[model samples]
Target: MRLVSVDIDGIERPGAVVTGPDGVDRVLELRQFTGAGSLALLLADDVALDLTRTAIGRADHASLPRLADVRLAPPVRPQVILCLGYNYRGHVEGHHEGHVDGETGQDALPYPNVFVKTPNTIGGPHDRVVMPIAATDVDYEGEIAVVIGRTAQAVDESDAMSYVAGYTLFNDVSDRGWQDRSSQWALGKSVDGFGPLGPWIVTTDELPDLGGLQMEVEREGVVTVRASTDSMVYGVAFLVHYLSQIITLQPGDIISTGTPARSVQAQSAHLPLADGETVTIRVTGLGELTTTFVR
Candidate 1:
């Protein structure tokens, strides 16, 4: 089942996408349930999303709003946005000029390189991201974002997957100039609206296996980044378990798995995103996110 946050009379409400009786995809009003399925109840009551899934299967379609009519909000307003750096094997293993040598890259890292971006960085999946005045080279990092379902601390690697709620797409936009100017990347990475996350959340139950999943990013109609989760140095389970040991993860928290290096298509013409241009990230089975850049 796909879960979405929707704009209802200027309020953010939980919704489920289901096919209408007439075969049109529509958004089911989850809040009307006053039960487990509501975003409020689901999170605070720890209600099983199974209830929502079941409802979607048998929802009354006549009253539901067509997907095209309801404005979407970012799937979840995460309390904290955790990010991984250089987590992809392609990035660590001989990706670009002066990149790490393949022989010593993957195993050389002792732990996942983690970073934090504030919740303010979140934006609607189709929102316009304004180019920072100080930025000269605006770049995008397409990532698979993991949304945590339960509170966890020091969970075993074997059991970490259980904490996941669902998956969404994220574009980690950055100012290459600001990023390279200092050893610290916070300024470059945490600009408001830098992270465009979600059209909706595809529940983990629908996609439990990630070993061979593909994620790609397109810019100017060219597939700039194409990668598989199999290329990650630290798998999702490992990263979750490792981070849980350090900090407690709560429901609605997100972990953005790092991106792979640019594909050969992008390397040949490495131009930064310009005003009015758009970037799209697609993850098979998850969803797609498109962000337009603006001045």
Candidate 2:
């Protein structure tokens, strides 16, 4: 079931998207539809409920309110946002001038390249990504964010997937200049409202083959990034296990699995976003997340 957080009559509420009795798409307020109080509870369940049988019950899609009318928020308010860098071979190679050589060319990174963006940076679909005055080159990196369902510490690689609640889309907004100036990536990545995620969260059980999904980013209706999850240098399960060894992975914690090639940086040599431009990022199963840049 796809769970969404929506604003109804000025109050933010949890909702589930289900087809009603008339085979129409409708958003059911969780309180009215199911005993589940929040999306987090639905995610924590091990058994997937047949949405049609329980909440949806075949209603007319036209009967539901238009999704655009509601104010969107991140599907879940995460305690922390763990992000991975250079997790895609193409992204690593592209940043180094299209050369993938390990010995003498651009692909010579010594580590896995990890970083963290604070939870305050998180926003939701239709949120605005503020282009800081300090940044001259703000770029968008579209990535698949993994949401952890249970607390995990020192988890084995084989058991990593068990801790995952589901997946969502993330726009890893970056200030390229700040990133290059500082030895640490936190300054460049942690800008408030830089990370925009979620229209909804899709449970892991609903999507069994995570590796086959595709991700893409579009700027002002033009596609800039396009690639599949198959290109990830390190998979989700491995990263969870890797991070669990060092830090505790708690429920509502988010780990962005990294972006694919063809992002803003890869397409343009040195172009940064201009004020009033829109960036849209989409993942196969997950929904689209759009952010408008403003000075």
Candidate 3:
């Protein structure tokens, strides 16, 4: 089932997208059922979601709201946003002059190169990605974001997938100049609204093999990034397990599994995002997320 955070009548509530009796998609508000303030609050409430899913399946059409009437939020307000750097072969070994070599001599890196972005970075799926004054060459890194369902520490790779609640789309907007200037990436990555995530979270039950999904990003009607989740140098299960060893993974914490190699820098013209241009990231099963850039 697809879970969404919705804004209706100035109140934010948790909802699920379900087809009604008319065979039309509608948003079923789960507030009455789950008694949760937000979707983020329900990540660990698996039993609540399971029951809600069953109820939604048999819910009356008259009781549901038209999907168009509700405004979508960022889906979840994550407590922490951990991002993987150079997990994709194409991104690590870019098709450019300054690309890094991906030959680690091993099948994968010893561990995932992880970085943290502040909570302020989160923005609604369709929200505008503000071009900060500190930024000049802002580019998009469209990725698949994993939401943790339960608290975990030192979880085994074999069981890490069980901790995942769902998947969502994320755009890791970066300032190329700032990113390259320092050895650390947080300065270039954590500007407010830099992380545009979600339209909704697709429960892992509906998408078991998360790595098999396809993802792509578009800018001004041109497809710029295209790749499959299977291309990650360190796949989802490994990253989660590795991260758990260092820090406890809590519900609503997001791990943005690395992005594929496609960005404005890859354009023949070498252009970064400009004001008024919109970037749309689409992960096959997870819904599309759009972010318009602004000054």
Candidate 4:
């Protein structure tokens, strides 16, 4: 099921979208059955997912809305956003030391490069991201994000995926100037509206084999970045297990798994995002998320 948080009559509500018997796309008002007001609450426990699936089985046609009529919000309200930098092998491309080897050598760190983004940085899928005045070279990093299902600490990779609620698309917009000023990435990555998330969240049961999914990003209708999740140096299971050892992963906390190769800086001929431009990213099965850049 494709779950979404939508704005109806100025009120944000949780919904489950499905194709009705009439062959039309529709969203089932999940709040009624789950007894939860928002998607965040619906994802808080396993019971809610079971209740949602039961409702969908015998849902009333009138309760469903045309998918296009609904305005979407970020599917979940996360307490903190964690992103992995350079988790993909080919994304660095000489921009950083030891990146060329692509994690083959013994010198690589045991843990991944993890960074944090403030909750305020998150925006809806269709929202416009204002380019920061402090930096001129703004770029995009399209990645697969993991939504934690349960509180986790010191978990192993074998038990890591069991704690995941679902998956969503994330656009990790960054300002190269601020990002490169120091080794730290928060200042450049955590700007207000820098994180564009969601079309909806596809539960783990909905989309298996996430590691084999294809990812692509387009700028003004031109495909600039393209690769598959199989290229990630740190897979989802390992990332979850690694981070859990240091921090307690909570429900509704978001972790972006990192973008694939060919960001603007990684490509020799690629151009940076300019004012009034748009970037759209799609990961197979998760759906498309589009964000516009403005001065």
Candidate 5:
């Protein structure tokens, strides 16, 4: 099921997407039945997940609402949005952005470089991100984010995937100026509306081949970032298990895996987003997310 939350009468209601017989995609809203209007609430229940599967499997797609006409909200309003900074080899180590680096060099850091984004930063897939008054050099990082479905603490790497509910696209927007100002990443990473997430969540069952997932990011007709999860310095399960060692992960928590290196075009001619410009990120099975920038 393409787990999602749809807008109905200006309100967000949790839903699952089903393909109609005529080949059109439609929504199967779950809010009324589960009493869970948010993905955070809907995903916390095993019964809700099961009910969604049962209902969607038997749904009459022809009678369902078309997904195209519905407005989308951030799939989950996570209480804790944790992110990784340099988990992809191409992102650092002085190589071309997408080129894989050897185990030596900056990639040698065994520990994951993790950071936090304030809850205020999370915005909807189609939300217009307001330009911050204090900074002008804002850039974007396209990432694959995993949503936690179960509470986990001190979880092992072998059991980490079990805790993940689904996958979603995330834009880790940043202010370069502020980021260079300090060694710490919080100020640059925590700007309000810096994190744009979700068109919907693609539950793990939909795509069990996690390692081969490909990711791409485009800005102003140029491919700025392109790479696969196979190139990640730290894979999904390890990152989850790594984080669980420190803090308890609750259902609806988000952990954004780091962005790949910028494409050659980006490395040579990249520029901060201008007002009205848009960035679109697409991953193999998780779907695409397009974000517009506004002043």
Candidate 6:
């Protein structure tokens, strides 16, 4: 099921299950039904509610308000936003220019190039992305993010999928100049409002074939990036297994499986977003996330 976090009137709230052909979002008040913070909480249930059954059985949807009337927030309150770099072959070749062959004329790193984005960097779907004047080379990297459901350490690839609660869209906004200035990507990637996530989180059962999903990013209505999850050098299960070996992944932790081929950096010019510019990213079953740039 598609779950969302929303702010009704002035109070912040969570829980929305996708319903209908009109694209109308149905509200599932977590406090009343589940007493939880995120979709991860719901997934922890031994007998998870089926999306169709839940939607049909909800008495609140008829008595309460529609989701479009409320302000939205990021679907999950992620503790850490882990990101992967060069996970897709085309993205590495395109963004690195001719350097896709590697700096030493060798090959790219055999394993996933991992980095972290602070939780503060995350914003909701309709939120404005604050563009820092300190950097003029900001660009967008659209990716599919996995939300962890269970606490895990040294998880195996075979069991990795069990730890996932759901998936969401992520925009790994970066300051190209700051990123290249240091070997660490923290300064460039962890900027405030740099990570825009969610319209909602789709439960893992809702999307059994995530590997076949398409991801696309558009700037001002023009598509700049387009590729499928099939292009990923290391898939989600492998990432979860690899990450758990080094760090404990808790419920609410987010792992954004890297972007596809096509970011402004790939074009070789600083495509810094101007104030009022909008970027929209969509993943095949996960829905869309839109953020406007503001100074």
**TM-scores for every candidate against the unseen true structure:** 0.90, 0.85, 0.91, 0.90, 0.93, 0.88
Instruction: Give the per-residue lDDT digits (tens) of candidate 3, residues 182-203.
Output: 5666777878899998888898
Candidate models: Cα lDDT each: 0.79, 0.75, 0.80, 0.80, 0.83, 0.75
Residue-wise C-alpha lDDT for candidate 1, range 92-207, written one tens digit per residue: 54442122335656447787777788788899875799886877888888998888888879999999999888788888888767766666677778888889989888877788
Model 6 segments more than 4 A misplaced:
9-11, 21-23, 36-39, 47-56, 60-62, 93-108, 263-270
Best TM-score goes to which candidate? 5
TM-score, ranked from best to worst: 5, 3, 1, 4, 6, 2
Distance from true location, Cα of 122 in model 4, Å: 0.6
> Among all windows of ten consecutive residues in candidate 2, which has the lowest summed lDDT?
97-106
Cα RMSDs, all models? 2.8, 3.7, 2.7, 3.0, 3.1, 3.1
lDDT of 6 by residue, 250-295 (tens): 8778999887777555455435788888888888888788889888
* Cα lDDT over the full model 2: 0.75
State the lDDT of candidate 4 residue by residue for 1-295, as single tens digits: 7788887766778888887878887888877754657787777668888888888888786667788887888887788788987777675634532124353432264667778888988888867999867766788888888988788799999989898889999998887767767766667787888898898889888875476788888888788788888778887788889889988988778899877767564376756688899888988999899899999
Lowest summed-lDDT stretch of 10 residues in model 5? 94-103
- 1-295, model 2: which lDDT tens digit per residue? 6778786554557776775456544676665533645556556555433552365555456667656566777787777788877777677543622123354321456555678888788887867888877877788888888888788899999999989887888888888767666467677787888998897778776765478787878888888888888877778888889899999988778999877778656466537888999988888888788889998
Model 1 residue 121 CA deviation in Å:
0.7
Please list all clashing residue pairs in model 6, or write none if there are none: none
Query: Cα miss at 71, model 5 (Å)?
Result: 0.9
What TM-score should be assigned to candidate 6?
0.88
Q: Residue 136 deviation, candidate 6, in Å?
A: 2.8
Off by over 4 Å in 1: 21-23, 33-48, 93-107
For candidate 1, report its TM-score. Answer: 0.90
What local lDDT score does residue 240 receive in model 2, on the 0 to 100 scale? Answer: 88
